[model samples]
Target chain A: MSREPIRDSVADLLADSGLADDGVLAHALESLRALCPPEAPEPSGALADLLRYGSEAVGAAAPSRAAHRAAEAAAGNLSPRVAPAVPLPPRKLHRGAAISAAVIAGVGLSASGVAALGGVDYSANPPQAEVRSSAAAPAEADASVPGQASKSPDATVHQAQAFAAAASGGSVAHEQPAAPSRGASDNALAGDGAAASSHAVAPSAAVWRSERSGAARAAAAAADDALAGIGRDDAAVTASQGAPRHRADSAPSRGRHVAQEAAAVAQALVAAGAEPIKEAVALGQQVRTVAPSLAGLGSRH
Target chain B: MTDSLTDHDLVAGVLPETELFSRVYQSLAPAVLGYVGARGVEDPEALMQDVFLSVLPRIGEITGGVAGLRTFVFSVAHARVVDHYRRVERRPRSVDYDPLLDMRAVPSAEAEALVRTGQTDAHLLIGSLKPEQRDVLMLRIVGELSVDDVASVLGKTPGAVKQLQRRGLKVLREMVSEGVMAQ
Candidate 1:
């Protein structure tokens, strides 16, 4: 019932039917032969007329035939039209290399910066820190002292701190090495019990000494500035002493002059002197223990 | 088996030569005639030409090579045959008989050749079989189409085509035993 291997030609059908045994299928094929005659009937018209006419000229099923042709043509044309894709350029910079390069660059820059800096002195009279010895500090500050040490970045921070403390009337005890005094003694508060104040204030009898007040210092400076004139140009002096931000263009020379004057004033304050009026400690008699070697053990034993 | 010479060769304009198309015309025209004639068309030859005419321009669109071309050629032939029947059923000519539209107007050369062979009654005998049986027989035996190709042409399953072929053959065998077909 199933002629599975398709019989493509008459020879296949005839061979399949009578190939092995010519007995049954041969006779059957013979009997079946009467279905159509031996000779094929030819057409009256030429066969080539079919091709000669084409679909449009024939007009037989023209509309639908054209639609089918169009559809099939679309499907057929798609395969050959494809262009090969363009390849992207290969990556040159990988993630790890970039990150590592950035880290190395940062480390190199940091080392270069640290190498360019000098150490913070913090010594009592480090370079230009000796206030009283250099009487002409303000005058020589532009050419010499500023070039020496006071113009250091660390020194700027100390100056800023001193300004804040002085502006606060010594209430803001700065944590920095206080104006080179830290090297001379332990970082002690400014008020009392300083060895220099207790013993060295008067070298002989009682040379009463105190710093000149700001107004008195200003008057003395104004009087000494002209050298020959009676009344001076106060406005000119004030204008010349511009704030640091305003004087950034000529900061090095002018800034150093201001710093040296401040240092001179600070040294004057540090110079040994007796206070005619002393501030007594309000804690009447707080017991202070002295070490045995220094106290003679009078109170301890 | 599929032929290497597909419809694409025709459609692609590769087979522009008349000699090339002759290959197609030679291969299919006779088979299409038998298939169209078996369906009882008045002018199977003319209709077969029409089938090819419809196929020619669209030939490039046909895929699956010659076997696919074979299927399409037979399919168009079948539809043309159907359209012939529909036209016949729908319209009646003014005249009682139009010789051009009449199969009886002309005796075929094959029928004439078969006269000496005693197979002269071939069409008459085949005309007696069921319409479906006649289709299966003519498509398979005369057209030499495969059972699957017959199924595709007839719009039936392979099983249906096979059953029809078997039944038609059995009927023919019965006719042969009765001396109706053999004579």
Candidate 2:
């Protein structure tokens, strides 16, 4: 083939190369030349010299790239290799060392450890005379149905007496039932009056009875809630200053005993001049009635 | 007239460690940078490094001596562009390429002074085209890819590229002519 034809064919083939189309490449190059100057970065003298030195060194160097690669490969393979197993911390292997130590100490002094850990005295039991007598009396009463010996002021009291003796040699009972009477009043006002006065003294019993009076008031409230459905606006009811008429009429039917108990208790509490005891008693009764009514409402809901 | 260099000969002669490769780097690095800059690389020098690194292995495959090597380096740079985009795709798209990075040529301090002083209406005119047209035009002009390359990249045909380019140029020309006529 003629050189001209050969060159033209070669140029055609060059155009055919998938790398770039001649037209786009030509335009791009032209635009690049126009846009960017060749002398954009002035090379530093030191950098130029470094480059020259590196190039000259490579030109004259004895070790080829392949040889260098081989040497690097050999170094990688032949060098002594040590991958020591990571030393695990003692805590990692024995996860709960402190807990294990505690367990071991507990096991060594088993009974004391159980008591200490449980926050109780295992050697010294709560004086069992009361528990034994109480447990025996229940069985004895079961055997003899007519005997009311089990009801004789409770074995729990004697146990309390014994505990009191142990606590401070029976001086606690003598020093004051009055101080504990306050505690008794709180206990009496704790639940329904029977439950309240279960161990309550005269003062606590009076307070519990007043709580029964509050029950009268609450019964009146419940009757009102029943008639008015408790849905009546309190503002309107309070503004009216009277309960719904239907409840007002029926209040006496259920409230007479509660009222009598309340008045008597109130008189006793007033005589004693224990306002907190009186209030607690009153609130207890109120709570008793309210609870039932609230329960009824809940059941409906 | 020419002894086509083998890979071994090329590695020994024209690689980075050799004299010929350094000369090629000095001569072609700027042109390659300009090419990449024109296509909107923020740092064309970094792009030039990438191009050379890619082409270094396949230097002997390019047939026509230094100019041929230059073209091959550009092709490698173009491939690097595809790689850059792939990397960019992996990144959060919320991070935007800076708009200033699109300026291929930064004017010199003197030229900038003069240009600022001059009464000029120098603005991006491509904004006049519809979004699709502008996209096609930018890909063709700045990407320096053929119609087929653009089509393949866009999942279209060369015919589609030609049509869009024609329509976009026509609309731009009409807008300019209309503005001129109005004046």
lDDT of 1 by residue, A15-66 (tens): 4334434334335543334433233344334335544554334443343443
Residues B44-150 of candidate 1: C-alpha lDDT, one tens digit per residue = 66676666656655566666667667767766666666666766778974667667567666668876666647534456556667998787767666565777778
Each model's iRMS: 7.7, 12.3
Q: Give the candidate number with the greatest lDDT.
A: 1
DockQ of each: 0.08, 0.08
Clashing pairs in 2: A188-A196, A211-A281
| Predicted structure 1: clash tally | 1
* Per-prediction TM-score: 0.40, 0.28
Q: Rate residue A109 of model 1 by lDDT.
A: 89
Show where candidate 2 strays beyond 4 Å.
A1-33, A40-301, B1-19, B64-71, B85-183
Docking class of 1: incorrect
**Tens-place lDDT digits, model 2, residues B78-143:** 555545666677885565677655567676799776754552221223445665565455444433
